[model samples]
Target: MDSIYHTLRKSNPASARILVRKVLEKNNGNVSKTARILGISRATVRRARDGELNDLSRRPKNIRKKMDCFLEKLIAEEAKSTGYRYRLLSYYLKNKYSIECHPPC
Candidate 1:
């Protein structure tokens, strides 16, 4: 079976970082849980989360730009809605918008 790292190696590094953050948040910021899910070391996940891992597979800059535009639109819409805090807004952005902003949790 292919390891999770091997599988993710083919994806955009930015997307991978976003995925790692999402997983960590979903698991309540548990490094061990994120590592188990990714089939990597807890240290590796910690490094990536801290932006210390530089071997990221970058996507085309244009693609990233497009994603950022879409995320901005979504955030604006959500921010206008009632009873939405920044933490919840960030969480919604990750889960629903697929945007990788730091949740206020």
Candidate 2:
């Protein structure tokens, strides 16, 4: 028989996952043997067996807001009153309103 690793190398990742599933079945569901035969990790064999071949999302669930709503509103009001741009407005807020102004984290 041809080397099992050769079968995996000849196919793309999707097809390789499918092949891993088939090989796993042929190996009587032995994850270690399946991984050794296919030249892949045991985790990868388990994922393929469980139909989890797709990539997972990397995005974080909770995004941090750049600034607080109250602070933003206060800045907008100050800007309208003084007609000052952001850099100067930051200084104005610091000096006049006693609010520390810096770039949002």
Q: Which candidate is the best by lDDT?
A: 2
The lowest-lDDT stretch of 10 consecutive residues in candidate 2 is: 1-10
C-alpha lDDT values of all predictions: 0.74, 0.79
Task: List the candidate 1 regions with Cα displacement exceeding 4 Å.
Answer: 52-105
lDDT over C-alpha atoms for residue 91 of model 1:
80
RMSD of 1: 19.4
TM-scores, all models, native as reference:
0.44, 0.49
lDDT of 1 at 27: 95
List, in order, the clash count of every candidate structure: 0, 0
lDDT of 1: 0.74
Q: Candidate 2, residues 38-105: lDDT per residue as tens digits?
A: 77789878877886555557888877756788988999998999998868888999998898877444
Candidate 1 lDDT over 37-103, as tens digits, reads 8887888778778983347457665654344676767677888874577887778778875777875
Residue 82 CA displacement from its true place in model 1, Å: 85
